[model samples]
Target: AAVPWPEVYGAGGDSPGGAGRPTRGAGALVVVQDGRLLAHLTRGGRSVLLFSRPTMGDEDGPGATDPADVQAVVTVLSSLISVGRLSPVTVEKVNGTEVMSLGAGTRAWTEAGARFTPKGLVVR
Candidate 1:
């Protein structure tokens, strides 16, 4: 099923001119990596991620506990939790994929607005 999306605005919150509307219920994501606009991924069926070429600063990691990044994630998580949704917390580790203590569906259900999930230790 094809979704619909609104016209993506530019730095001034206006259309980028001759911009085509994307499928809705799809990519409305606001992925902000290191104070830069990385991508706006979708969250529905067969969701896809859309990105931009022009970026700012080096493509370096935001380091664990990044101020801006952390604030963004926490803001999103806090809103969800306040609405009786799911709880979310970032986990720090060296080299291992952290298992979501809340289970797969718990966090994977981002489509249902269940974003921001609490991650457990990355035990290998």
Candidate 2:
């Protein structure tokens, strides 16, 4: 897919103002017949990664997210959960907390990337 120019592109005389308003790209939404699937690559693209790992010689497969990052993620999520700081909490009428956010954009780039989604989604 062709990338839409960043919002800064308008200030540089590329966009016609609103069209140039910075966007984070298609909002990472994937359209499907039944519902809007969370941002993820097609199943066909990710299937190869299930049973295969690549080397310098392999060009057909996607690379995996580094395992070394697991500790970092666990530590952050644990601390956030324990402290109830997953979302912001600065408001007089409505208090919010720090909520961790993740997306499947990484999976789109590599089959080996872990795809994340929100839990407890009740599909009616």
Candidate 3:
């Protein structure tokens, strides 16, 4: 069975242009490498990631961001924070290049270190 789009959006309706509407119930894996934090969100077979620099603080650093993307990133961040997976100490560790992974659907930071990916993140 397919979920209706309206149900996904709740009572917000179809307003991608509206203020940042935090996403809910989406499974996400947050990976921190170097100064960047990448959150991979998956729900109903769809997946997208939002990347930002933890070292950048509240200022914009890098990554693509239209209004919708901003909202999505905000949603992911909100979720992470609410679950205690994101915090200043965590961000500092990430900025220091300590590898970290927050398992999807869980609030725990399962692994943290530099030896896990000494060569750094690889994309192929």
Candidate 4:
């Protein structure tokens, strides 16, 4: 399957302007699909990843929303930052809590409360 770039770079494949803007060539791609959260850090076309469980049929349970699933997502997201794939800077909002844009125009405080629809990770 192909990576969903539209969802990754927001609706129009453009990163919103700010410190959150992903570095042009080397960036992290985080995807929520098939009941799993797939995060990869790419540099110079090479990619490395961290995923939440396996999205393989009935072998694995449902989507990436359970407490365990959410935790896995958080871990991988933090890894992105720790690895320098993402910047630590972000706009503070929601009671002074900081929100960072995780490439593809998606903003997340943490992976804790993420919910995905058929279209992709719900942003709002």
Candidate 5:
């Protein structure tokens, strides 16, 4: 099923200077599986895949915890980033915590426990 981008990140307005203008931000591609975040892919920036089990109420079921599922999500996101399908996302500090603005009224905090690996970043 193709999840609509606007459903994940609220509808965004046009960039200043019309449709051809590019917005500024650390562009990224967020991947989710079974209602749980699987990975966050940033071009030329930090990228991370989930390695720990999601907390209660964070996922629809248990499938997202599987290694195969994680790998699949990472592979898809990596391909998208490499193909230049990444979207602009804003990063800012709020109350000493780094927050990533996904779109209008949508924001996520920076994961603090992520570690770099040969493949990319893994967040526990």
Candidate 6:
């Protein structure tokens, strides 16, 4: 699935100006398989892959997860981090689960209706 650039960068549309401004590159691309969500954000022919670690027991329960929902959450977060709207503090593995700590400088997450807790990201 392809997520539009406007959706990733908000109404500002990733430029100094407003919506009428032309964006530089294509939007984000997302793929979901085996209970994992992988989002690719491309710019200037370069692509960054953001993979969400599969939740516990997701493999055991087939179709328990919704790709669209996961795509929405991961794409937004990944895009924000990729474009420097959000800063990542650290990435560490906790009990085999990847944990990313982000800086508190930006309220973009909150504006996007998502928040990070001690456990993980919560999207409303």
* Model 3, runs deviating above 4 Å: 1-64, 88-124
lDDT order of candidates, top first: 6, 5, 4, 1, 3, 2
Which has the greatest lDDT?
Answer: 6
Q: Can you write out model 1's per-residue Cα lDDT over 1-124, one digit (the tens) per residue?
A: 3544323323222221222333345324444656664333234212212234212434221111123433443355456547765433333211111224223312322332434334432111
Off by over 4 Å in 2: 1-63, 87-124
As for candidate 4, its clashing pairs are: 8-104, 9-104, 10-104, 35-63
lDDT of residue 43 for candidate 6:
39
Q: Which segments of candidate 5 are over 4 A away from where they belong?
A: 1-25, 43-45, 49-51, 54-65, 81-124
- Per-prediction CA RMSD (Å): 12.9, 17.1, 14.5, 12.2, 11.8, 14.2
Q: Highest TM-score: give the candidate number.
A: 5
Per-residue lDDT tens digits for candidate 2, residues 38-115, read 122122111111111222332222222232332233233345536874432111100010111112213322232222
Q: In model 6, where is the ten-residue run with the lowest total lDDT?
A: 89-98
Runs of candidate 6 exceeding 4 Å displacement: 1-100
User: 1-124 in candidate 6: lDDT tens per residue?
Assistant: 2644222221233222211312345553344555554433333212222333323442312111233444464455566667886553221211122224223311333344545566444432
- Cand. 6 TM to true fold: 0.23
lDDT of 4 by residue, 1-124 (tens): 4543222212132223311222335254554656554443344212223233323443232121133544555555556657886543222211111123233212232345444343333222
User: Could you tell me which 10 consecutive residues in candidate 2 have the lowest summed lDDT?
Assistant: 90-99
TM-scores for all predictions: 0.26, 0.23, 0.23, 0.27, 0.31, 0.23
lDDT of 1: 0.32
TM-score of model 1 relative to the true fold?
0.26
Cα displacement (angstroms), candidate 4, residue 121, comes to 14
